[model samples]
Target: MIETINSSKQAIALEDKYGAHNYHPLPVVLSKGEGVFLWDVEGKKYYDFLSAYSAVNQGHCHPRIKNALVEQAGTLTLTSRAFHNDVLGPFEKYITEYFGFDKVLPMNTGAEGVETAIKIARKWGYEVKGVDENKATIVVAENNFHGRTSTIISFSSDENARKNFGPYTPGFIKIPYDNIKALEEALEEENVVAFLVEPIQGEAGVYTPADDYLRKVSEVCKSKNVLFIADEIQTGIARTGSLLAVCGNCTCEGHCEKQDTYTKPDMLILGKAISGGFYPVSAVLADDHIMNVIRPGQHGSTFGGNPLGAKVAMTALEVVRDEKLALNARKLGKLFRIRMQKLVDTYKILKLVRGKGLLNAVVVNDTEKGSTAWDMCIALKDNGLLAKPTHGNIIRFAPPLVMTEEQLHECCDIIEKVVREFEK
Candidate 1:
């Protein structure tokens, strides 16, 4: 058997030598994780504030999801969509019912789910809306982080993601996010098939839009006959105080269509926490009319609807509902913001705080190119809490939904102590 590596320095050195230089992760080397805490290679524990970009909203290595994965692995893992597995049908049915959709097309990653939705929308535009061949356009927002795929980066405004990556894909229009007038104007263009947006722009430093933004978007898409696709991969699954960010202010535990705040999309794309970070599982949900456009063989994946992922996803979602994670996130999120707001009032280093539910970010009073936010995060890690900076000067804080109120307060104390030290 291979010898186990015990030193954090050794692990970091190994990764630096063998791995591609794509990610600049925090310096801490994690070895184990539980509900709201992580242990480093050196036996130090820290609060997990990032939650793997909201992928572990149900918590790390959750027992229910793990049990389902273990049981499914012992039976059947994958049949490659060449043959039907016993779990796929049940998973599709359960997920559709859970989200109140007519059907669900399962995939393995958030990027794959996004690609699937793009194909479906384009096809529906051609066959149903009668858009000219090769003329269909999908509108997306500026500064949005869908994924790192080539097609996704084609429409990206981030020069770092787009530099030297051309010739970029066409048939996409970029609009300023949270601007209804710009959306209305863009919808006036011919062959605009859909408007794809994140209910809350998570990667753009947890930028929550206007409260009525999604509701208005739904109305505009309906009027323009364009598909409204909400990419809730990061903001869904109770991350933003509701089952889905599109649920808006609805207080229900699950998707409730009758609620006034509910802004139903033509197509919904979900991933990340859909499997509670135990496995890679994503899905696209739509009604019969829009989804029926794609016939057999037009789209599929070898591991898309595999038995292992399906079972884990089902159990993960069940945990979210049974534990009332949405309600918990809603309650704790308010308390977190209140605590952070006090820091902003007391410290000159902080500029402001803005977010929904547990997904929050604090803007540092420094330039985007400054290292103050990075330094603060390093200090936080040293103080036994983990967080990361986004857009240079903003620090995002998103713990697991399973985090208790007492743990949240303890984490807050750590953050406060770090801020005090940094301010000095």
Candidate 2:
């Protein structure tokens, strides 16, 4: 690896030469990271405002989590569900109890967790909800970012994500986001089994719905007897300042509080921070009826419940509670957004800054579709804050959950400088 990666430029050139051009990532070659900061190959440092799309909620290379990974790796790694591993059972117990779910079906990626949830929901629809065999439809919100799986993209409303990707999978119907009316209308069709949605559409530029939108949607799904599935891959694990973003409360505050209507979801899909930025461990959690519906041989993964992932995830959850990242996000997020709003107020090029918790985005002036967001990201990079664009005109700014006040201020300073310069 050392002989091959002699320099960052060489690595970048090698990737450009050999790898697929699937992602148009910012041209910074990160070499090391800790907490909320990262260093490029040339030793130039930048505040990590993206946090691997909210995967590092526990921070980069967290010590305790790293210890767990190292320890478990030395003990046991993969046992492949053919036989039960000691760590998997205990890990599942901790996770389900922590999340208040009766059981958890683990997977290696957010997208796979989503696929598992879809399978379980469809099966439940057939067996429990009583939808027709193959015709059972799952309602999804337009512009939602679930994952990049084929079936996921089939229901996607984004033209770019869907073009040339199918021979699409059927049985998903896209409804307008934030519109309770569209959801209600969709549910009018009896084949609706579940409604899969992101609490805040993160990849679509941290687009949060109206305050009561979640409550209203949950009520609609409840009234219609359809399961409410929350794809919290990006928004879960305190990214939005709650255990789950759909919990509707950040900072444990009742700001998202409501009657019994807004309290729960039938299926919860989690990833990113589940392993504390260590490995790719994701899961689908549900109560007895929904989770139990999956019998042996129904669903499984090679690395899903592996001991390494199990230990890492358990410690990761503990670190979140021990470090109080949720409360920190609540406090820092308000400051971050408030500071960005001030920048927005002063800058002519920025349209608005909006979000909940650390998951936030700035709407750049639509100069020409995607140009403004890309240029602004480049500017932000130059100014020492690292963020990326979602759509053409929106740049999301999500720092690590372990971000400190001083570090957040430094990032905000960079952003302010970039916007001020952009106004020129």
Candidate 3:
């Protein structure tokens, strides 16, 4: 057997020899993780900034969530839908209440949650909203990263994500993001069920829509009788300085203060952090009318709301609230961006920095012309910070919510150090 001391090297070798080469992940073999730090099999430690693509919002292996998983595992794991378990109902109630939705549908992954929502939105369109069957159209945004499901990829404008993946799902319309004019025009089309979007397009380099975008879009959806579904899988769970980015400060420029108005999108899709980086736990939430449209057998997953996920999701949510992660994200995010801007000012290759809350990005200028968000990411990893490039020229810096002010500064220093080397 391969020795554990060389586990990372051995694991990578095995994966290269056997696993499909789908992802081009940074060459970092993690042995264990806690809070915002991960250690390699050789015990070299690094600060994690991507936070598992915003999945580990409460931080890697949060103690409370880990405990919940342990205790629940020893109790009940899966009961399926044939017989309900003890935790599903409680998790449903806890989450629905937290997000201010009338009902909740639990799923295992972000994409699964999105699929559940799409199904619910279409049903709502036909049964309640009174759109004709099989004619419901959902509006998505260009450059939006909803998920990689076939139904999702059908509307994706990205060539890489959609290349050769066909025949694709239909009934989705792609529109330019942050353009209220296009959205209004699309809403006028008949049989339009919902406007499914991310509050802040995370995979698109943490692209935040124009200020007042969410509230305005919410108004548009309401006036046109189309559901506004926010796919918060990456941007929710306090990643964006709020319980949900859509909620904002409840007083921020783009957000709605009243629970009655909070862009409360007809449907709310959640995943990732819902399990605090443990088991995959996703949820779809909506008003009764919208949720009621999905009949039981029509939508269900074997591992969707199993007992283990339920317990993990319950505790996972509690960590976000109890830790005041939203406040921390907002406060530290501001500092991080400010510090990044300062670094940008001192370097030419580092072109710009922009983002909201803790989900931020730094644009790298091309040696020839274009931006270099990717090359610098390699340099960043070498400097003991693990971040990935988005598109080509944008590198996102999203640490776990467990990051402290001191640690944030240290990460900033590391970023500044690596970025200065890129300056030509």
Candidate 4:
């Protein structure tokens, strides 16, 4: 066996020497993870507050998901879309029935799922809605974090993501995220294909929209003959208190369509927690009317519907429902905010806390360029809880959904102590 690297210094040196400088990560070097906790190379344990950007919502190395992955790996791994795999059809059926969609097209990552949705919407516009070729425009929100692909980044408003990344793809319209008026106005424009948005803008510091935002937007899109696409990769699979943030208080463990609270979208894009972070698995779901627009030859990925990923995704989703993670997240999330709100009221450095379910952020009352949030995160890590700052002054806190109420209280205590100490 290769010699075990026990020192954080050695691991950090290896990454710095061999890896690309794309990410500026927290100083701690993690070695193991399970449920809501992570251990560093130096054998230090810390509460996992970020949950791998919500991909580990089912928790790291969940036993059932792991068993599925291992068993499937022993049997079959990759058999591309060129050939049929035994698990693909079953997995596809399971997901459609679970989410109440007619069909699902699997991809490998969240970005690919979003790209697939875009392509389908554009094609549907031309073939079904009668929009002129190359004139189809998809509406998006400001500060959206879809992915780093050339086509996806083309419409991003972030200077860091958009700057120097041109010539960008066209046929996209940017609008204010939560502004129903702006969305309606954009829909008025000719050849509008779809309105794509995250139910809760998780990357934009857990920005929750107004209560009626999703419902109203769905109504607007339906009225205007524009497809309403929900990018629920980060907020879906029980991460946002429900199966999806778009589910809108629907507590049913089964199909979302049956529930009165559910606001059905034209296209549902999903990834991240789909495989419980066991493997890369993402999918786009829609009814036959919209999904049938894309001919087989027009779009496909080599590893899109592989058996291994399919098996993992199916088991992962079962865990979400069987464990009632949505319900758990909903309960713990409220308690987290209630506790964090007390800290916010006491401390001058914290601005406020806002989010749905386990997805939450506490904004720092400091300038964007200031180091207060980052400094606090360092302090948090030192105090045995792991969290990181986003966009300079926003610290996102999204622990795994597998955490119990008692564990949540413990994590809250750790966070409270860190904040109090930082203030002092």
Leading candidate by lDDT: 1
User: lDDT tens string, model 1, 151-206?
Assistant: 99999888888999888999999999999999999999999999999999988889
Per-residue lDDT, model 1, residue 380, is 96
TM, every model: 0.99, 0.96, 0.95, 0.98
- Candidate lDDT scores, in order, read 0.95, 0.86, 0.86, 0.92
The runs of at least 3 residues in candidate 2 whose Cα sits more than 4 Å from the true structure, single-residue gaps closed, are: 253-262
Candidate 1: the clashing residue pairs are none
In candidate 3 the C-alpha lDDT for residue 278 amounts to: 94
Error of 2 at 70 (Å): 0.5
Question: Which residue pairs in candidate 4 collide?
Answer: none
Provide the global lDDT of candidate 1 against the true structure.
Answer: 0.95
Where does the lowest 10-residue lDDT sum fall in candidate 2?
A: 253-262
Clash pairs of candidate 3? 49-398, 364-372, 373-393
Measured with C-alpha atoms, the lDDT of residue 399 in candidate 4 is 96
lDDT of 2 by residue, 52-152 (tens): 99999888899999988888888899989999889989999999888878899999999999999999999999999887799899999888888778998
Candidate 3 per-residue lDDT, tens place, 49-75, comes to 999999998999899999999999999
